[model samples]
Target: MSLEGFLAASARGGAIPWSEELRAAREFGLSAREVEAAAFGAGLLPARYSRNAGTIGLAGQAVLHASCVAVAGCGGIGGHVIEQLARLGVGTIVAVDPDVFEESNLNRQILATVENLGLPKVEAAALRARAINPAVILRPLRARLDSRNAPSLLEGADVVADGLDTISARLELAGACARLGLPFVHAGVAGWYAQASTQAPGSSSLSDIYGHGTAPAERGVEAALGNPSFTPALAASLEAAEVCKLLLGLSGTLRGRLLHLDLLAMECAEFPI
Candidate 1:
């Protein structure tokens, strides 16, 4: 049967179940992600994404299913962000992280597990994401993101997500995203505090906040207070929401604004950039 016919026939109440999508993927020699996209293109929803329909809608789901996102770090905030984006059905995820999961990461990094302590963070993220949604493509780049490679490393992504811990790398990525004309969704976590924002290209938002070329190697406060398990998830959730907004072309994004969260006191504040 034709994929379209199969999808149309398999759909119930305008949505296709996972079992049917999987069967179609196997029958059509396509990835589950591709089949999901076909379902969307055919005006049918994937059942697993039914919960997302009300908020995302069919148009938003189509947008998200066609979007590609680059996650610069696969630990802590990065892991959580990747997981959220995967569940949210971003079509392709380019997960970049050079570090291995050491015992230290187990405290807050979602991708860190005792059995996979020595594995690369990107690989672990891929495993987790694939498990969550095989319809989401996982691209693992087990390399450091730097100025030299940032352009090529992130060129095709619709948005670049920040999960880096150092000022130097964040600045580099923010600058590269500016040059690449890509939107950057940034988040940082330390102890009970986290901040998130979306920066448009050439906004110099990160530069304005961190200053340009002034101690690029400096690490953020996470180095001092350390990341508890909650902060990264909090920050990454904000980042993932921003990503969804950007992909869906929705308004009220954090562009030119920074959101600060005091988890300890359960307070939230927004500051203009």
Candidate 2:
């Protein structure tokens, strides 16, 4: 089949799995990426992402489809962030999480499931990404991230996401991103409130915004006020949007400011560091 023939076939199918798409493209002496581009041009990669084309354009969409994002943590915020990235056509996802799914995680963790109760969070994230976008390449690291291993664990990512549950871990992840000169999307949730920000290297670090002594008395206020299903979802959505903007080289990122959301009051406010 020629490129046109593959596009026509893709249109007729309305979607094609990655393997079949590659096989068909190879039969026509075309690269898989070229076939993917042809599919997009032919309007066969599913209209699901068509809405994004208007906002980000075909060029931006291509950028997203070729981008790689690393998510540190796979709990409530991280899981949702990773899911959104994959669904938005990020070509590769590097997810790091040492924990396993538990009953406590089902509330807001999109990758958590009853069947995966004992599975590693990174494994669950990988499975979720595969099920959502088979074409997405997911690299799961089932290990904790500290300053020592952060760089290697998060290597090669265009941007890094801070989805850690503890204040100290968040600080550590932010420091790693800064050292690597990578953009970081940081978010945290507690009860009905959540905050998000994009930290560009040399700008305001997470520590600069929250301060070194800002570590919560406890692991997080969520332990007391509780983390509802909605708070992390809202926060992670903002973080994902920031990552998308950064990946596409767009402006107006929350580089030196924090976006705070209060679901209880239904208000969103941004404040400078």
- By TM-score, the best candidate is 1
What CA RMSD would you report for each candidate? 1.3, 3.2
Residue-pair clash count for candidate 2: 0
Residue 73's C-alpha lDDT in candidate 1? 92
Q: What would the TM-scores of all predictions be? A: 0.96, 0.87
Off by over 4 Å in 1: 211-213
Backbone clashes, candidate 1: 0
On the 0 to 100 scale, the lDDT of residue 123 in model 1 is 89
What tens-digit string does per-residue lDDT give for candidate 2 at 69-164? 999899999999999998888888999999999998888788888999999999989889888876678899998888899778877899998878
For 152-247, candidate 1 gives per-residue lDDT tens digits of 888689999998988878888888888889998998888999988888977779876775546654776777899899999989999999999999
Task: Give the range where candidate 1 is weakest over 10 consecutive residues by summed lDDT.
Answer: 208-217
